[model samples]
Target chain A: MTTAATTHHSAVLEHRDRFRPRQAAGKGHVSVRNVDIVFDTHHGPHTAVQGAQLEIQPGEFVCLLGPSGCGKSTLMNVVAGFVKPRHGELLVDGQPVAGPGPDRGMVFQQHSLFPWKTVKDNVAFGPLMAGVGPREAESVSRTFLSLVGLSGYADAYPSTLSGGMQQRVGIARALANYPSVLLMDEPFGALDAQTRTMMQENLLEIWSEFRNTVLFVTHDIDEAIFLSDRIVVMSASPGRIIADIRVKLERPRQAELLTSPAFMALKRECLALIREQTLHAFEQQNRKH
Target chain B: MSVKPGPFQASSAVVPSSTGERGVIQADGAATETVVGTDAVGAAVEASHARLPANWRRYLVRIAALVVAVMIWHLAAVNDLNLYLRFENVPNPVVVGTEFIAQLSSQTFYLHILHSMERIAIAYGLAVVIGIALGVMMGRSRFAEDIILPYIEILRPIPAVAWIPLAILMMPTEQASIVFITFLGALFPIVLNTVHGVEQTPKVLVRAARSLGASNAAILRHVVLPGALPSIVAGLAIGMGVAWFSLLAGEIISGQYGIGYFTWSAYTLVEYPKIIIGMLVIGGLGSLCTLLVRKGCAPLLRWQKEAGRS
Candidate 1:
């Protein structure tokens, strides 16, 4: 299925290849070893994630599926080097996760594009910071902008773009550095149902060509089912990987296949696991209150 | 640019080069042009038409208000009206107008205007430089804030006028003293406003820039400075007004040649008409200077105007 999709989408592959980041140092192999994250609150120390362990192979599409406050985002942040684990080691491409770097491209939930910059500059930012010359950076931006189908909005500011377009620009900005891994924190969570569905499919199309590792954090089981090659369901509060389910769905999964028997079977299993975890979490919160 | 940033913007996210969604792209293209063309043209026309008559009306009302004020002043002065309120022997509009026209032709009048303008230009320029630097430093660093804030708080309340005696004693010359006073007046507003602006910058923006691999210096340049600009400009506008206030006080007290000096000398000589002319000139120049400051700052703040969020 993957091979067929590759042949079928060779045109897209050409465009994606032309615009891929200069240093295609594709080394997105993430290793999380006994990761524990704690936050200081007024009440006391609160464990967000405890003894979390996972291994993500380079070029693999994976989703950390869980209920909100389950520390999925915290774990992702640890990989992105925004949050340091209180205890344990996080390695990306055998390098220690030290601080936020261009090596891991991040697409935030709110499409945190710099509002002051034009769309082109926003995409150019990663390359520019990595010491790319101004003209080269601009060319890099133009290529990626074209790849994201936002070639026309090069001069337009981010505030003027729609939410989805802004997120697309965000993706373009992140990918401009040719990062080994893309950390998306519910990139389409704010979109309407149709747009979210469309975004998921569009994302898969981009992913197919680039084949960069993706650690997509989301609570939506359908999104996980549709996008990921592997679904890692996290348990509620003090998040840990409870179940690591491999998705057997074929590549270039379409919206129509969302209702297929195999797809529904996988969705049903994820739904039950999430429902059970969510219910347990709710009860725990009720007792605390 | 014709793209409508609507919810369906996601549909455009579909690769047109890809085999699927060609019909959706064509449909979106035609619909977008129609919507953009009508919306842009209609909004432009409506905005211009709405602004034109209102602007004309404002100018006319302003002219009428000035005329009425002059008329009331003329009547009161000519009739020696309000004698009980001690408004007697005040210069009438005609006398002041005549004197103003006569003064405009005199070399001394031009010299006075030039001297006042030169003092303000030098002092205000210096104030802007120092104020912005200090403000940004204070806003960016806790150490700078702690060190500078106490002195600022102590000095801000002490009016520029109150600084006159100390300024005269400390400076080498009277001109230096007057310029120092004017600089002091403009400094506070510019610094305070800049600090406020910088501090008010969104934390998310800083984080976003950081995550994008920008260093601290880059974040300050790309994020904090632009974010803080609108407030800094507002501070500069206010600073110009306060600078003029101090400029007048400085000129009146110890000026060798300025509008304020002319007005003070007129009072001493009992040349009431000349005093009134000086007052009018001073008011005109003060407002003109502030208008210039606002205009100068406008280009730097184009992002705010273009946002059209309001």
Candidate 2:
């Protein structure tokens, strides 16, 4: 089922590759080498990401594309410095990742907006955390919210927002940090297909304006192929980068690009890699059970 | 941001609940998956909603029934039921109502009510102050929760009335004993509710405060305290109810002056009308005080149940 889905994804992406718009963010790069993540579970410490290495150049969009249980998110966390690898290092801006910091802002699959806080306040959280006064935070937050097309939702609470709108606020909050590196883990994986596509386009548009290095994680090959300047296909369980597909696409890419051949070609290749990895991971789990 | 919490929210268990260890995820502070309305979850929720009693009809019926009952009693008493074997001392409903009104004018009766209310007020106030402090402390700290909780649980089952004899013996005077009895009644519910409220304060709110650079004290003040307000008010309501009941019982058992004492004194003289009037006064005061407490707490607890659906 997954293989067929991946194939379909690749076909669509190949169609969009005709118009894969590239943005210039060649100045900021993220480097990860043999990043190994082992989490302690009830049975034992399980290795999630293993020997995953990738070089995401500055101002370029790179997607860590893989199926669920492929450790795509763990790798993103490793890059963001939110997770420390048991072996090897993940670097941002030529420095080894240590702990979560302001330089790399993360937007998770779930919108982590504070429920009691207004949209403006949620967007301003990072600035406030960084000791910016309310006046300064509000000013910066408004700009980001406006960028996310949420200028009118400043005083509204997140509960009032549609899923798509909340995701926009999440993106705004992450962007408001003014981070050089943006790390997103399945950020749009929860959205409906239509909304997800809209967000993908919105993401690229935002990246075009801000022009920062982004390490986006997703299970969707089409999404990776469409949005990423370079796509890193990861294997399941002990995740490793199997393929680094460079999307030869143009800048300011639109929805119409999903019909192009080049995009489909990359998507097909990544889909094949992800299906094999996911099936194998499932087998490994079944065997252990 | 739609942070207005749902009405009747029973976030009974924190997220990742299957794991026994206290791993709290404050959904209140974080955005949860606008959970896809999977058929299974939706069906279960619908079932629960359907099972909920539509009690408005029952409530109206109960009010009607109570009115009918009162009318029956007034009619029974007014229509010569007191004439047969019942002594003239058993004043009819009209005479009893007159006596109640007359008693309200008498300075002696007013003093009796004043003494009873003053004792209950002092004890209930003390219970509120001390119970909340201890409860909040226990709720916040794991060590305190462990140390103080067992003792509270052990003492809670014992009736407040059971402490009357001990209170009378320990206190130097009857008034002090009465106050102590009220304290016994009010203390447990207040402390338990406060602890539960504090304990249940969303960890996410606390984390949100932490992320915003709020200090520990600030987190407690801005998040935990406000988060616990509704539950604390609920506790106050329960504790106040208990205090008034205990006050009446204490006055009846051992008192020189008070409504309880006056009622029993009237009973000995076969003045059933006076006894009934005393009961009426006690019931009226209990309800009025409860209303006052509710009024006082409502504004402070304006954040109560708003969001309904998950």
Candidate 3:
């Protein structure tokens, strides 16, 4: 029985390998060049991000960490091609981003899994949209579902699963596309602390395997510190990159590492950086009011 | 996990039911049924609650209420208690019941029913197709909405019954005129509801699909359609109810043979009992048709059931 399970697991992995993009191709090299994003609000034109310049190396796990209402998500969306920059250029590898495409996969804060579809179908949607055959898409879904440890829930509806499970499926769906860049917009922000931590670990494990360049947007300092190779701190509202701190921690990170001195040091650094900016933003709001 | 299997241990080997709601919530990816929050009496109550299908129970209650209403009507008519209502002229339950049973044996009665069903099926089906197509077009494109919305708004306000004169004049055949009236009745609700549903589809889901490589057409087919479905279903339900009303109105006014015509004819002949029988038949058939529609659409709406269950 164990051998059968192992064989099946390996078979799925093999199938995944066959479908997986060329190793070099899968690792996204994103370059955001002095990008500015403006939104025409009911009040007036509001700058969401201003002069946001950042470059992510291939296979790097980067987090855009900032306070609420910060344009971290907006900047990430620019990379995802959901939001076009008003000025300056955003490129993936050397190609300029025109709009959202197959090369970049996104996981939203709200597990936007198509409720009409079953778990496997939702995961297979990317492949099917990319014009893969139904049979092959189904198999790709199976492999990714297994990858996210949700192999048994292939037939279940998204609404049936708990929030954490739904998010896991969301991750699996994103990964199934074999995207060069995985863009996450506060993906685990809605989950409870325990689930959030577990998801973080699960995400790292998956990232370690796939090594797709992940651009995670979040307000949580601890999460950024834990999951990212580099934490890019941005100032609140009309967000600008303030600090870039590389995580010096070892890989294969465990739950116990949260208490480790190295982890605490990084967390403290990020917390202080965020705190100063948050206070500044608060005072600015007060002045405006 | 120490379980020494003995005959005296657990009265029943506890089945690990997720309940998908309460219990010591399992923090696993799989919705594993953890054996927590066990209480024999509580479990029995919950099991009973779960076992008794809500839909069946709801229908049973409706049937009971209907029966009670009929019994009261019977009592009032039989006793000639015109205290509030004119019960003296009304047919009693016994007379109506006997007529109803007799009508069931008559081929003419079946023909009336079959005719009514066929008319409703065609009209309602046409309404659904046209309404959905128009609604989707309006919802997706601002230009379409601007161009077509004024005409829809103008026509939608005018009652389906009011359309009968124009419909009869416009259409050559009586059947076509009746069907047109019924079609008009069902169209507006379906179209409006579909529009609302389409417009309400979350932008996030569309963006997510787009990021996943779905083309604009694919997004519309998969995301917009399903997202708008609950509202569309609500519209369809309302559209169906209106269709029945319009069918009956059209039939009463101009139909050669239908359940509505049967009731109208009975009234003309002053056969009070046959009128009541016809009314009851119409009510029963209408309820049954609506129930069938809801049942047919149930599988499409399984995702919503999970929320209600939990």
Return the TM-score for each candidate structure: 0.85, 0.70, 0.85
Model 1 TM-score, all chains together: 0.85
Docking class of 1: acceptable
Q: B212, model 1: CA deviation in Å?
A: 2.0
Q: Give the per-residue lDDT digits (tens) of candidate 1, residues B37-149.
A: 11222343455565787678777888899999989888888888975765586988888888889988999999999999999999999999999999999999999999999
TM-score of 3: 0.85
Model 3, B70-140: lDDT tens per residue? Answer: 89998999889867778898989889888888988999999999999999999999999999999899999
**Clash pairs, model 3 backbone:** none
lDDT of 2 by residue, A1-289 (tens): 3553344334323322322223123435687787788999999999898787777777778888876887988777676655678988777778776666666777877635655467898887767766667887787777677667677778876665666677788888877766677878788887778777778887786676567888888878788888888888777666666677788788768878898786677667666766775577668768988
TM-score of chain A of 2: 0.83
Cα lDDT tens digits, model 1, A177-265, are: 77789999999998778878767777776676578899999999889989998998887666777778888889877788788899889
Fnat, model 3, is 0.42
Worst 10 residues of 1 chain B by lDDT: B17-26
Instruction: Residues B1-310, candidate 2: write the lDDT tens digits.
Output: 1111121121221111110111121111112112211121233345556556865576688889998876766776666456455544456667788888888789999899989889888999999999899889998998988998898878777776788889889999999999988887888777876777678766434543443445667667766776566556656666777887788789889998888888888898878889989988887887678667766865554322111131
Question: Candidate order by TM-score, highest to lowest?
Answer: 1, 3, 2
Error of 3 at B10 (Å): 23
Instruction: State fnat for each of the candidate structures.
Output: 0.27, 0.05, 0.42
Best by lDDT: 3
Model 2 C-alpha lDDT versus the unseen true structure: 0.69
The candidate, 1 or 3, that scores higher on DockQ is 3
